[model samples]
Target: MVARIAAPLRRYLDTEAGSAGLLLLATLAALAWANSPWPDSYDRFWHTELSITLDTHTLNLDLKHWVNDGLMVFFFLVVGLEVKRELAMGELTDRRRAAVPLAAALFGLVAPAVLFLAINPSGEAASAWGVVISTDTAFLLGVLALVGSHVPTGLRLFLLTLAVADDIGALTIIALFYTEDLDLVALALAALGIAAMLFLRYLHVWRGPAYFVLAIGVWIAMYESGVHPTLAGVVIAMFTPAYPARREQVEEAERLTRAFRQSPNPEYARAARLSIERSVSLNERMTRLYHPWTSYVIVPIFALANAGVRLDGDTISDASTSPVTIGIVVGLVLGKLLGIWAGAYAAVRCRLGEFAPGITGLGLAAGAALSGIGFTISLFIVDLALDDPQLADEARIGVLAASVLATVLGWGLFRVAQARQGDMPGRPLKLDPPVDPARDHIRGPLDAPLTLVEYGDFECPFCSTATGSVHELQDRLGDRLRYVFRHLPLDVHPHAPLAAEASEAAAAQGKFWEMYDRLYERQDQLTERDLIVHAYELGLDVERFARELVESRYAPVVRDHVISAEASGVGGTPTFFVNGVRHVGPFDAETLAARLLETAPAA
Candidate 1:
C-alpha cells in the first residue's frame, strides 16, 4: 500500500522501521564516503561499468545505472500503484478530496520550477528543474524526529498528505518533460506487456511472482521503447485494481468471523498457521509483500546511489553564487513556501477549499515551508533534468541548502503555533452516546502513533463502525493512537437527541463509553429515562450525575471538539481528523490502517 506502484509494489518497505533506519545509515554513509578523502572511490564506484543483456541485445551502464534503471523500475512501479490507488479511493479519489492537496502540490511544484528555470536560463547545465521542488519523506521525517515532542499530530498529518500529493505531481513532470526519443518496436512490446499485466489482474491472479514477471516484461519493453523506462511503472499502474476488495466482500469477511467462531477449516487453519509463522500475514497480501520493497529498497537505493556530493572546503556561496544552484536553492526554500502559502490562502479565502483544523492560514504557511524538504525525489529528479554535468552539480548544492533551511524554519513555525495554542480559542461539543469510562483521558507522552480526533454522531451507523475500527487500530498500534472524541450531531439523524443526552449523562456518571455503548447498541432507544437507566446501570453517582448533566459540565469541552471539526471542513457527521486529515465516509478498517502506516510518526 505504501508503494506508489499502480499494482501495489511496496509491501517490502512497509512494516520495517528497523530497515528504514539501516537505509538511513546507508545514505548518510554514502554522503560521508563521497565527501571524504576517498571521494575518488565514490565517483569510481558509481561509474563502474555494468553490462547485462538478453540473447541478442545488451545494455552497458555504470553501477549507478543499474540502481536507477534496474532497481528503481520497481520503485517507480510502487509509486505508480500509489498514484493509481489514490486517484481511485484516497485523497484524490474524488474532486472534493483532490481539491486542497492537488492545488497545494501544483503550486509546490510549479513555483520552484519557475524559480529554478528563471535563474538558470538556457545554459548547457541549466535544465534541471526536477531537483528543486521535491520533498523527501524519509529524510524529512528523520530530521523531524529529532524534535519529537513539539510536533502536533495535526500538523504532521497535513504535511504528509501534502507530500503524497506533491509526489504525484513530481512524477508526472518527469514522465512528460524528461523522456528521450521513443523506438516504436520496443514501445509496442512494452504496451503489450502492460496489457498482459492488466489481463492477469483482471483474471484474479493474486500471485506476486506473476505480477513481478509481467512487470519485468513491461520494464524491458519500456526500456527499449525509448520512453523513460521508469514511466512504464507508472502507466501500467493505472490498470491495477484500486478497490481490490468490494464493500460487500469486506462485510462478508466480518460476518464469516462469527460463523467460524467455533469452527476452523482444516485447510485454512494450516494456511493461516503457516502465514503466521512467517508473520501473521493475511489474505490481502499484495501490499504486504511489496510495500517494504518499495519503501526500503527502492527509496534507500535511490538515496544512497544519488545523495553523494563533496563539500570539502566549500562555501555556501559556492552554490549560492551559481545560477543553477542558486535557482534551485531559492526556489525550493523560498518559492515553495510562497506558492503553497499563497495558493492555500487564496483557495480557502475564496471558499473553494477550507483550511483543516488546528490550522490557521499562518499555520498552513508554516507547513508549506516544511514541504521544502526536497531530498529523495529531488535528487532523483535532478539526474533526469540536469543531464549536463554542470547543472547537475549546481542542483546538488541548491537542494542541500533548501532542504536544511526549510526544515529549521518549518519546525520553528510549528513550535510557535504550539506555544500559542491556548491563545487561539476554539469550541468543541459532545454528541449522544458516550465514551467508555475505562478509556477516557487515555493519553501519555509516549503515545504518538497518531492523534485521532473523531467527530461522530451516535445515530450514524458509520460512527458505530468507526468505534470498532478505532479500537482495532488501537489494539494493533498499542499506545500509539491518541484519540479525542467530539459530538457533531447531524440534523438528518432522528435518534441523535437521546444519544447526546445519554453521553452527557455518562460524562456526569464518569462512565462515558458505557453510556455510549448503550446508545449505539440501542440507537432507536433515546428517551431521557433510557439515558437515566443506563447511568444507573453503570453504577453512576446517580444524584451527582443528574446535577452535572443539568449544569452541562461537559458542554464547553464538547464545544471545542465541534468547533475543531468545523474548522476542518466537515460537511457531515462521522467525520474524523487523523493526524489532521479530514477523512469522511467510505473509510474501512484497512484504509484507516494503511493511512496510519503512511502517516506513521517520525522515528
Candidate 2:
C-alpha cells in the first residue's frame, strides 16, 4: 500500500517545473511567516536544540543547523552523482563540447569574486566574497522552463552544465576558505572511514546498510575535523561505481525470468526479482532512490529554513547602502551576465569549443543572464561567510532582489527571440529565390500586401488542421491575404512524397486548390489508386494526371520547396512564414490575423 502511494508521488517529484514551483512556494511561505506578527515564533522554532547520543559521544545542534548540515548532505550527494555521471557518459564526456560551459563557469566564478572584492576590498564584508560566485541550478533551470518551449534544448543543456561547473567551484571555496581550526586526529579518522568505504567497494560489498553505516561515520568524523560534513557526501558519491552490472548478471536474470515463466511458483518469482534487481548497478539505483528526495523534499526544506528574512523597514534601509548587498547584487546581476557570455564567446572564437546546434548568439546572451539567478547556493554561502546577522540579512536581500530581476530579464529576452526567429533585415517572410509564379500554386491575388507561405505535408495531421485556419484567414482577409503551399513531405511519412506529387499534378491541370482540399479531406487514404480516383472526380484528364505522376515532371518544384524551407530554418511541417518572416508564435487564426494585419498597407 505504501509503495502504491509513493509511486505517483515520486513521478510528480521528478518533473522539473512542478518541483521548482514547490520550491518557490516554500520560499514564499518562509518569507511570509518570517515577517508575520509572530515572527519571534519563527526564530524560536528553528533554534530548538536537536541532539543525537551514541555511547559516550554526543552530537548537538539547533534545528536549523541540522537541516543545513545534516539533510543537505543528501542533496550534495545527488549533485555529486550527477557530476560523476556527466563526466563518465553525458555532455562533459566530450572535452570540446564541454569546454564552452566550463570556460564560462570559470570566468563566471572569477568575475563575480573580483567584482565583490572590488566593492568591499578591505572590510569585514570582504570575507563574504564567495557568496556571489555560485549559480543555483534549481532556480535558474526553473526560470528557464517558465520561459516556455521557445527556450532551445541546447540553451538548457548549456545552462545546466554551467551550473554544475559553478557548483564544483563553490564546493572548493567552502572547503578551503570556510574551515576553521583543524583537528588532526578527527581528520585521520575521517580518512580511515573513506578508506573503509573504498575497501568495501573493492571487495564487491553491495549491501545498503553497510554503506549507510560507513557514510555516517565519515560525516561525524568530518564534522569534528572542522571541515564541513556535507563534503563527505560529495566525496562518497564520487566513489560510486558508474558502470552497469556485469553481462553475466544480466544473463542470469534472463534465465531466472524464463524459469519463473515456466514454473509459475513463488520460489521462481522471488529468484527472478532478486536477479533483476542485482543486474542494476548500485550507482544507478542510488540516483533513482535519492534524486526525488533531494529535489523536492530536501531542497524545499532548506529553502524554508534559510529563506526566512524579515522584510520590515529597518531591514530594507540597512540593505540599501550595505556594501555586502551592493557587491552581491553587482556581482550576480552584472558580473555573471558579462563574464559568462564573454568566456563562451572567447572559447568559440579561439576554437576551444564550437556552439552546439540551435544555439545562437542572442540565445547564449539570454542564457548567460539567467545564470545570475543564484538563490540556494548564495544563501548557503551567506551563512558561512558572515557571522553578523545584519550583514547576512543585507546579503540575502540582494540575492533575492537580483534573482527576481534576472528571471524577468531572461524571460523577456527569450520572448523577443521567439517572435523574431527567422527575421532578416528588410525581409519579413519573403521566399528565398523568389516564388516562381509560373510553377507555384497560390491562392488569393498575386499583389496582396501579405503572403502566408506554408511548408506542409498532406499526411501530417497538424497540416490538415491548419488548412482550415488558412481557409478561414483567406475568407476573412479576402484579396489582402495571399496563401501559398509548398511541399515539405518528411521522409518519416510513407505516402507524403507521392501526395506532394499528386498535388503538383493537380496544379498542372490548374485545379490545385480542389485537389489540395481532396487530399486533406481524405488524408488517411492517399495511395496511387486514391489519387487517380480523386483526379477523375475533379474532371481532370485521367491519362494526363497518371502521366504526370509516372513521369515525375514537377519533382524539382518539390525539391526547391524543401531547399527554401531548410534555408529559412523550417524544422517541421505546417511551419508558416508570414510576409517573409517565420512565425514562431501561436498558430491560431486570431494571432496570425493580428500579425498579418500589421503588414497591411496604410489606408
Candidate 3:
C-alpha cells in the first residue's frame, strides 16, 4: 500500500537508493536502543529536563518538549508556506482542483477522530483525538517508497495531497482542541506584542529579531492563556510574508524609478533613486534573509531526537491496554482510513468532485490506511498532550504498532488492486496517464516533438555550465529542439529557483534565450539587482520583467515544469531528456552532438 501510495517514493527508498537506508537506520537504532541494556540512558536522553529563560521571564521543559514545540514550529511554518501557495496557485488553488482533496481530507480527519472517540469515549485519550487524525508524511511516505515501480504516479500524488491536507487539519486540532486554560492578562500582553510587530511590518520595518522577541512574548501569553503555547507559533506563522505579493517591491521600485523619470528637475532623480534603492534593499533582505531552516534541519533533528522510542521488555499487550496507547493506536489506524474514504466518497456522491481515473475508492482507502502510519508526528503529539509518564509510554508503543500496521495494510490493499487489474492478461497496465493540459501544463504550451527538456538548479556550478550548452543547442536546432527548462533547485541551493523564475519572466517577453544566457554567463553573481540587471542587459523591458517576477507571473510555468519533471522521473540537477529519453551521464560537446546528429533529419 505504501508502494501504491508512493510510486515515486519506492524508488527513493529502495535498496538501490540511500534514503531508505537512513530511514531503516533511524528505526533500527530506536528499536535497538529500546531493547538494549542502555534503555535507561536512551530514555534520559530524550526526556532529560531542559529550560530556557530571560532573567525575569522564563520557560522550562524537557528535551522532548524542545523538539515537539520549539522545533516543530518551524516545520509548521514551512507547511503554512505550502498551504498558502496551494491556496493561491497549486493543488487547492481552485474549488474544482480543491474539491477532491477537501472531500478526502474531511473524511480522512473525521473518520479517524470519530473511530477513536467511539473506541474510548471517556478517557484522557479523548483529548488526543488529533493524534489518530494525524499521519506522519515523512516516515510513512519514506516507507512506502520501499515499493518500487509497481505503484502508479496518480495514486502517489493523490496520497501526497491527502497527507498534506491531513497535516493541516492535524495542526489545527492541536491548536484549537488541545490548549491550556485561557489567561486574559498574559494573552492581552501577547496580543499587544504581536500588534507592535505588525505595526512595524505596516511601517515597513521587518527586522526578524524584533519579531522573534514579540513571538516569544506571544508564546508566553499562549502558555498562560490556557492555550498550548505551540499555538503561538501557528498564529505567528500565519502572518509571515508568503511573499508580500500585494506589496510588490519590484513594482514599488519601478514606481520610484518612474517617478524619478517624470520629475522635471534633477531633484526627482535623487529622490527616486533613494526610493528605488530603499525598496530594493528591503525586498532583497526579505527574500534573501529567510530560508526554510525549519523543514530541513529542525524537522530532521526533531525526528532524530523524539522518534527514538525504547520498547525494552514492555510487551505489546501491556502497552495496548493503556488509554493513551489505545487512543493513539485506534485513532491512527482506524481513524485515517475511514475519514479519508468517507470524505472522498461523499464528495463524489454530492458532486463536489471525483477521484482521478485509475484511482478507485479502494485505492483511496488503501492510501488512507497508509496514512494511519503516523509514528513521527503522533509520537510528538503524545509528548505534549498526555502528562502521565505511563500514558506517554503507552502512546509511544501504540504509535509504533499502528504505524507499522498501517504501512502493511496500505501496501497490501494497493497490491490486491494491482493484482486484480493485472489478472486480466490481455495487456499490461500503464503506470501513469498522459499529462492533462489543464492541470499539468499550467502556463506553457504542451505537445512538441523532440521536446528537449532541461532539469537544472539556478545556483549550481554544473547547472550554470549546462545552461550555456542548452542555449547553444536551442539556437542551433531552433523549432526542432523544443527546449523546456525546469527548476530542480537543491534543498541547499537557495538562490537557484529565483534565478530560474527570473529567466522564466523574461520568457514572457520572448527573451528566454537572452535571459537564460545572461544568468549563465554571470553565474558568480546572482543577487537581486544582478537579476534585474541581466533583464535590462537582455533588453527585456526591465520594469515589466521585474514586476512580473516579483508578482510570480511564472509560478504556473514553474509548477508545470515541476509536474512534468516528476512524471519523467527527473530527480536532480543537470538531468536532461532528448525527445522523452533520459540522459544522466555526462558527455562532451562532440559525443552529444554526434548523437543528436544521428537523430536529426537532413538539413
Best by TM-score: 2
Choose 2 or 3, whichever is better by TM-score. 2
After TM-score superposition, what is the CA distance of residue 330 in candidate 2 from its true location, in Å? 0.7
TM-score of each model, paired residue for residue = 0.67, 0.70, 0.63
Model 2 misplaced stretches (Cα beyond 4 Å): 1-14, 244-249, 264-271, 422-603
RMSD of each: 14.8, 12.9, 10.0
Rank order by lDDT, top first?
2, 1, 3
Ranking by TM-score, best first? Answer: 2, 1, 3
lDDT of 1 by residue, 1-603 (tens): 011112232232223233546556766887798878788898898999988778998888899877887777766666666666556544454464346766777788888888877877786555577777677666555544554534443444456557768878878778777778978998888888888877875775555688788888888888877777778767766665554333334344545554455577776555444333222112224445556777667777777788787766453456667887778778888988988887766666667655444566657777788778787777777887666665576677777777778888887887786667646443222221233324343332234657666777888888888888877777777676777667766657755643665586676556776777777787666664566676777898776665555443444344434445454555566776656566544566677777767866676
User: Is 2 or 3 the stronger prediction by lDDT?
Assistant: 2
Give all candidates' CA lDDT scores: 0.65, 0.81, 0.64
Clashes of 3: 16
**So what's the TM-score on candidate 2?**
0.70
